[model samples]
Target: MKKILLSAVFLFSALSYAQDVKFGAKVGLNISNLSGDVEDTKSLIGAHLGGFAEISISEKFAIQPELLFSMQGAKSEYSESDVDYSYSEESKTKLNYLNVPILAKYYVAEKFALLAGPQFGILMSAKEDFEFSENDNGITDSGSESIDAKEFYKSLALSFNLGASYSITENFFIDARYNLGLSSIAKDYTDEFGNSTSLKINNNVFQFSVGYKF
Candidate 1:
């Protein structure tokens, strides 16, 4: 990992002298959800802030690398009823990550660019808040709780980014992107019999942002 980062830095430095380089910062809205091994899931609203360097490779091509702090997760609700009892639960999971993405941008038109990339994320925190209610033969109970869930997830995640950007002015732009997870974010568990099982959850996110170039 260190060697790879060093090589990237060297390459970026070399390219900076040969092409136009732009540095910028962006803030965005994130709509995130968890998929696989979970039911009744919905998107969670979050935010991301980032900085990037864009190096123009040609009249229509560029390479952009970004470092971002992102908040992502999902919300779920479940309910069941029987003649003797009824139960319901709602939960919200929050995950925080430091993300690095190296993107290739192709200008399809003077003001529009298509973007694709691989995003690498390092997990920072995981937590969940849940509430439950139960009724049994006219008896009722309700409760809420919060749990630290970092240990249940893996430390790293890999995802693919697909998006487009529209330059509104010389130094300003707006973009929308979707990140599709390629690696499972949940950890596996080993049993005494030497078998391993996992929840097989992945993170999916849609991002909308406004940025300025300097």
Candidate 2:
């Protein structure tokens, strides 16, 4: 990612400097994950749709900020290790949020800039499910014991971001960034047989995307 940042700085420098603050919109893809007690081994492609503004501080520096609707989460498998038998199950978690990122851009050339900042996200929705075991002749154990279907969004998180951006032209740019969650998402859980439990959901995010200015 640092390599990408370096390249972005050079690209921005080669472009012509603008007198007015630039404003535009962008839509791109995101590869995300959820960290913590439950391992999010599987990563899914999500979307980043937003608009941004660039106010030139000088010939080589600017304040860049954006507001976007981002979709993120993780996919994983669960199994019974505490039970008498061994079995596995699969699950998917989908989290939707409204994210705001404010960054400082340092130009290396003219059109390429290095970007870093703090990103704040507000939770909108969270959904999850578990797959059933393949074995038969046993009672269907509801995974509820391991998962609490309620109070999930109480985990809304905040994170720090470091990234890079490129201006393909004076009106369009593409950016890539990494977001490290600063908060932990804790949730109430119910075990299979009937047990109350708690698990901490890690909010770390690895994101890469492209955007354009109007």
Candidate 3:
């Protein structure tokens, strides 16, 4: 196991050494959703703020890694009889780690390019809020209560990124990307009775960013 780990590290370092690093910050809108039992929560609106470094291995290839505080989750709602219950949860998912994304850039023209790559997100700080009814007064008075909960990270989740960039000058560019999450964020939950709980989370993010490509 140690040998395998060392080998993987060596290979990654070799690849990284072969690329040039481009540093930048990105802020974008997030349109997220929750799958599985949490389906009632439609597209949840959120945002992402982070900084990234793109390592250029060649003129058309690079490895980019980032640290971002990304907010992702869903909005859920249900009604019982005349009483209504609904809540939308947004997780201030702070991901702190090195994300090494090997990107393949194909230039459509001198100022236009398309990029495709895979991203691994390591969640650092994860928090969630619950707005529930304490009583059944008109479906709980239509009032709300919120509580902060801990979200445990199940290690790194795989994701795919596809985007296009337009460079107006040597130091300026605009990028539009679609990131698809490929892991289930559901950690096993058990009550005091030792029974398992059915709760799951997945990654689904849409990002649009404009940056200075210095």
Candidate 4:
């Protein structure tokens, strides 16, 4: 029993010493948009900065987990009509999140890899900028406002990421990814008519990043 235990410990130590672990930092740009129940929506340009750790499990496989500060949202326009006037509004919504993703990577070539994973995001802030115009008897009124939108959005979000990474050198790489939201971002609320409704918005983002490994 003592000899078996000693042998097991030696094997474990050998495996640990053979594993390759690396750490790095990254910065990127995001083109984000919201989908579902919205009209005339456009993509918003945002940015992300983060750090990550990659643990090599085999020659062709690795696990990477990252912590990132990400900015995402959309731009939209809509028109409404009343008995006396017609109005149009344009809005841009901004959301800030702290995101964590755990990815499984498989190397297909010596310097290129494919990764897919689940990501969890915690909302940090939300805001909306609005521009409004109304026409009454051909007279036009235009104004703008900025408002806090945090209460209208969910605090937690879930997404799936599909991406590829190419190593440019021993310590540098470029990454491209798409994130698809699996959970709705809107909070439930009552409308002006006392009917319960939700915005039913989901986030979609395409990200490009440059990273360095140490």
TM-score of each: 0.87, 0.72, 0.71, 0.82
Weakest lDDT window of 10 consecutive positions for candidate 4: 1-10
Q: Per-residue lDDT tens digits of candidate 1, residues 108-161? A: 999999999888899999999999999999999999999999999999998889
Write model 3 residue lDDT over 24-137, tens digit each, in one string: 876667776655545456676777777766666667655555566666666655444444434333333333323344456667777888888766666554545444443344
Which of the predicted structures, 2 or 3, would earn the higher TM-score when compared with the native? Answer: 2
Model 4 lDDT per residue over 1-214, tens place:
3533553454355347447888999999999999987777899999999999887878988878789999999998888888788999889999999988777789999999999987888999999999999999778999999999999999988889999999999999999999999889999999799999867889999999999999
Point to the candidate with the largest lDDT.
1
lDDT of 2 by residue, 102-206 (tens): 677899878777888766677777777566564334544544323533366554566778888888877767778888876666567677988987766666566
- Per-structure clash totals for the candidates: 0, 16, 7, 0
All-Cα superposition RMSD per candidate = 2.6, 8.5, 4.7, 7.8
* Consecutive 10-residue window with the lowest summed lDDT within model 1: 2-11
By TM-score, is 1 or 2 better? Answer: 1
The CA root-mean-square deviation of candidate 1, after full C-alpha superposition on the true structure, stands at: 2.6
Alpha-carbon runs more than 4 Å astray in model 1: 1-18, 82-85, 135-140, 191-195
Error of 4 at 79 (Å): 7.3
Q: Alpha-carbon error at 66 in model 4, in Å?
A: 0.5
* CA-lDDT, candidates in order: 0.91, 0.70, 0.61, 0.89
